[model samples]
Target: MKAWFKSGAPWVWLNGGAVALCMIMVVGLLGLIAVRGFGHFWPADLVQMSVLDRDGDRQEVLGELVRKEVIPARVARTNGYTVAEDVPLVTRYLIKQGNRDLGSDFQWYLDVGMGEWHYPENAIVVERREWGNFYGFPVALKEHGEVISRLGDEDFWPEVEARVERSVDLHNEIRRKEKVEIGSINHKLERLRLERRRLELQGVSPEEMAQAEEQFAVEREALNEEYRRIKAERDAIYEQIERDSFDVETVNGMEKTIHLHNIVRVTRSNHLGVFGKLAHYMDRFWEFLTEEPREANTEGGIFPAIFGTVTMVIVMSIMVTPLGVLAAIYLREYARQGTVLKLIRISVYNLAGVPSIVYGVFGLGFFVYFLGGSIDELFFPASLPAPTFGTPGLFWASLTLALLTLPVVIVSTEEGLARIPSTIRQGSLALGATKSETLWKVVVPLATPGMMTGLILAIARAAGEVAPLMLVGVVKLAPSLPIDGNYPYIHLDQKIMHLGFHIYDVGFQSPNVEAARPLVYATALTLVLLIIILNLTAIKIRNTLREKYRSASD
Candidate 1:
């Protein structure tokens, strides 16, 4: 044992154990998150039960069981609940009775006061475009406010499904028209206004200005014509959606008509087989990936946050790579190796340790205010006082993240450059190559893998950053994507959503805590997957470059 300790075997074993423990911890944490989040998509059976209300009367409740926990009996008693004197613990439930049907989002009930639980086969669970979910029993299918079919009729469920499918298609069509087609028209009209202002700022002659206005008027008239046509079509769709609705009866016998247009999903999971449950799960997960968020980000999908996160990371990577590589090349290969260079390198290293929020503050002040304000004053003066570029936006956010991650890149690239054998440079010089040629063609190529390593690290950090993004560009919701059919398609001036910020918003800022909890886990898992994918891509490129260079050298 003493010899083994002296040989460093004991230390090696300790290190290995530490690594294995860390791996277990990471896997365990991921497993917990996955179980909690991914299960949220699976259809849970509707539960019907009776619980003692605040007034000591038994009231029927129907919905999904969110969670249950045991608490001290004293805690329950303190909340104005009656408990037996001998009971030491009380079990309580957080029942998601649903807002649209129960007039409550969720309620806490003690198990002692609850009656027997019933998994009702006839219960219906509804996911809507707004107002969260509705849990009730199907009463009848209606058309034009009249009952067309009641339950147990051969055509009742099928007809309801058909109408729902039709409504969904119409809703998607109207959304496309509003968000894409008419949105494009509005963007173009704004461009025309800006262009005219630009020409005016340049002090164009009256003839030129009048000619521009004539062309602009023609285009504007055409856009308005198209806009009106789209609006009329959407209005027709709206009428069609309103034509179908279904009546639902709560367990307490309260009836309400739910418009088909408002419904996004309908589930009767009590009869779902294994495959049926799997299909339902996949459908919900896909919708969560593809749909836009609704209802304070407590419902629907997080596609915007995903898109924005990827876009910001890509933009940040693009801005950082060349700048970091160039700085590293200049510092390691060209700059004088003296005290001043040492100071500069130390400053870069120190910048890495600076709190990220400090970078956000600097970016907001310098990049957004000073630099962007100057650009607006000089170039976009036509849109002045409105401050076109003088705002926190995608460009500034990417730039801020680039700055935050610059040191890592510079350090990695410098190490890559330093690793290129001195003999290789001498050989290149002996072959009659200029110093710059040898440095660029030989050294940089050999260092490509190292630069990519830096990029992977930068992307991982930039993609998860929330604090800096909040000050720079991230918002709880963005009206539209930064990239669209508009000219200058990548609108760097636009605000964007990010998965990290989305998690923060859903977990903390959401009005519905229980609804947002699972979403937080799901979004967190998504972010982890995204970062993994990005890092894997970079690693693949780096490995390819390293192999190519190694084979060439051999």
Candidate 2:
């Protein structure tokens, strides 16, 4: 037994080490992502705070904060948080008591105004003067604990709801006034039109007729002026409605209303009381990769990134498959061993070695600048100096990646074609099968698994690529979605968001670096998971093909 073990020991050791290394790498990546990215979904206790200004224009505040000791089973009547049901079992278990909707749970803000620093330990905020805050207008809260639990009470939330409703009523009143003014303007304009008709038919002297026409024009101008004012007034009222809402919290079982503007700092779960902090971590783990992109930070959803990556892959596959297969067929079957074939092989091999960034530069110059510039000049003359094709976008970026990965597809297909036993082709020819049919029916099927393997590698590499995409398609912030309602509707030229780019933007471009670091890790984890999903899909295809063709290949 020892002798037999020794004989197979080298192979066992090599395989075991490889497996261990792969496991370690995967575990380390997931751990980092869990700690940083998904970990942010938990709730923290609200810290009642107060601020004092040197001038003291507005002062004095008192309120009692009320909260629940245990989270209710059905706190929300509507849909709860967007946690995926498909995540690891452990993640599901941890999130049982976590925040149902993370967005409404956690709260943080900052204040740096003129005065000696007055950082009160825990102060109940009774009323807010304005909606502005250090954490911007919006904030998040946790599901459980005193603050969020108390939020469920009708008495606790009635004032905030009332304020919002009052603001809305004010806006509606302003709109009603504007509508009346507009109606008056329209009536006057209609009367002027009738007067103009009468003047035209009266056969008055030309000079008098012209003067009356001028008076009518003056009335029309007055109508336009009044309408503009009405619109402006409506807009102002709408803005007022948006400025009235804010977040509330309970600290030490006391209800405290922190005015948005008075908020001075934002701390993570560390400052949240024990259970509140635990809930935060639990939510982070539970959310994992399942939440829709819409639920992400103000930066935007991960959906766009997911869509862009998948769309690019599908487009690249559609484009490269035919070209690659054709090139492979010619090289393996039609082309004889000669200088041309040898040169072609060398070029294909060399193309694979070129850096991906170079392809991006080439794509930007040729597809974007040259071809796209020409198209823009002919069709989109109205939107000048901003050529659609000349700018970086998904269409051009996908094309660039397709070019970069083309060699891999061709090489794989050629290898697959080469592996077909000559006897099969000979037998097909002997049985009156033409070369085309022989290649299609006999060779292609057997080679599918290998070709699929190549495609998988290409997708894995392309999905993770960021540097090349940066030059051609990625944008820091996209106000409108990539696909929008506009002329030539597809809008392939529009820049899109991506997870990799999101990581870069948050990590490097953010004004609050310390606050954004965790976000960067979360984005990175999302990108990594996206790439893994793509690879897994490709692997599934490869497996299916392998199963289908196993008997034939054997």
Candidate 3:
């Protein structure tokens, strides 16, 4: 063993073991997240259970059994639960009885208190827009408050499904008219108003100003008429959607009337086979990726967050690459190798080590309050009091992230420049190539792979960062995406949603912790996947560059 240690075998083994252990831990963590997160979408069996409480009162409970665990008898007893003297461990279950509007959705029951438990074929799980979930047995179907048909426990599902589908379609149409059609009209009207104000500020002639005002009034009148027409159509659709309603008997023997418009999906969880459940899982997973979030971001999809994250990263990359590359070239090629150069290098390295939150504060103070405020004051005085550019937004957020990752790019690029053989420059000079031409044409080309590597690292860091974004542009929810159909297309002044911030909000700030827990894992997994994809794309480019340059360098 001593000889092996002296031979460096022990250190080699230690290193290999450490790498293997890290791989195991990472795989395990990802596995846990995937199982817990993705499994939430699967159509678990709805169970009807009879329970005898500690007070000896009996009641029927209906829900999906979410988790089961064994607890120490001592701990169970300490929690005021009675445990059998012979039993050293007590089993308990967590039931997701989702109906936030009714009462507590999550409940725990000791196995001792649980009586007969079985999957009832008629039990239904209703996913709603406002409430978390509703689990009960269908009783009847009504049309406009009138009972059209009474249903036996198992007979109502098919009708319920059909009506729910119609309601969902109508709901989507209503949303489109309200959010897209009316929204576009509203945006255009606001822009016209802003334009008129801008023309007035530019000191237009009285005749031009009158013409502009006349145009604005005409446009506004047209837009208002269109809005009224759409509003009337939307109201008609809403009335149609609200016509159907269903009655369900709760586990506690209370009947509640729920409108079909309010229900997003109704699943007969107890009756679904494995393949049926798998299909349901796929459908839900797709929706989670594509739909806008509702219920304080605890329910629905994270498309907005995903879009914002990718957009910000792209913007940050665009801002950082040119600046970082230019700075690196100046420092490594042009600047004299003196005390100033050394101090600049030291500063770059130190900047990389500064706590990220400090960068956020600096960015807020400098980029938003100072630079942005100045831009607003100088150029957008017409939009005064509203503060167009004088706010945390996509532009400032991207710029701040660029600054934060600038050091990585500079260091990587400088090192790449240093690695080229000095003989290459000498040969280029001898061949009558100017110093500038040689540097740009030969040295930069060969260093492309290294620059890409820096970019990959920068993206990996910037995409996952939340602290700086919170101060700069990220919000719990954004009303509109930064990119839209508005003038200039891309609105840099708009705040954006971010996956990192979404995770933070859903996991920590959500009011419904249990409902949001699975979302946190799902969002986290998505972020990890996104980073991996970006890094892979960069790596592919780097590989291509490396292949192209290998022969030239040799």
The best candidate by TM-score is 1
Q: What would you estimate as the lDDT of candidate 2?
A: 0.60
lDDT of 3 by residue, 1-554 (tens): 88877999888999999999999999999998898888878888988888766666888888988789998888877877777788899888988998788888898888887888888887888888988789998889999898777776454667778899999999999988877898898889888878988998899999999998898899999999999999999999999999999899897879999998889998988788889889999989999999999999999999999999999999999999999999999998999999999999999999999988888999999999999899998988778878887899999999999999999999999888988889999999999999999999898998888788889999999999999999998999998888876677899999999999999999999998988999999999899989999999989989989998887767
Q: What is the C-alpha lDDT of each candidate?
A: 0.92, 0.60, 0.90
lDDT of 2 by residue, 230-291 (tens): 87887786666545434544322222334222221233322356775676456444433433
Q: Report clash pairs, candidate 1.
A: none
Q: Give a tens-digit lDDT track for model 1, residues 1-554.
A: 88878999888999999999999999999999999888899988888899996568899998888989999999988888888989999899988888554477888999887999989888888788888988888999888988999989999878887888898998999899999998998988988898998998899999999999999999999989999998999899889888989898888998888899999977888868899899999999998998899999999899999999999999999999999999999999889999999999999999999999999999999999999999999888989889878999999999999999999999999999989999999999999999999988888989999999999999999999999999989999999999988888889999999999999999999988988999999999999999999999999999999999888866
The clash count for each model shown is 0, 18, 0
Please report the TM-score between candidate 1 and the true structure: 0.98
The lDDT, on a scale of 0 to 1, for candidate 1 is 0.92
Error of 1 at 31 (Å): 1.0
Once fitted onto the true fold, the runs of candidate 2 whose alpha carbons sit more than 4 angstroms away are 1-8, 46-154, 158-240, 246-300, 378-385, 485-489, 549-554
**TM-score of model 3 relative to the true fold?**
0.95
Per-prediction TM-score: 0.98, 0.62, 0.95
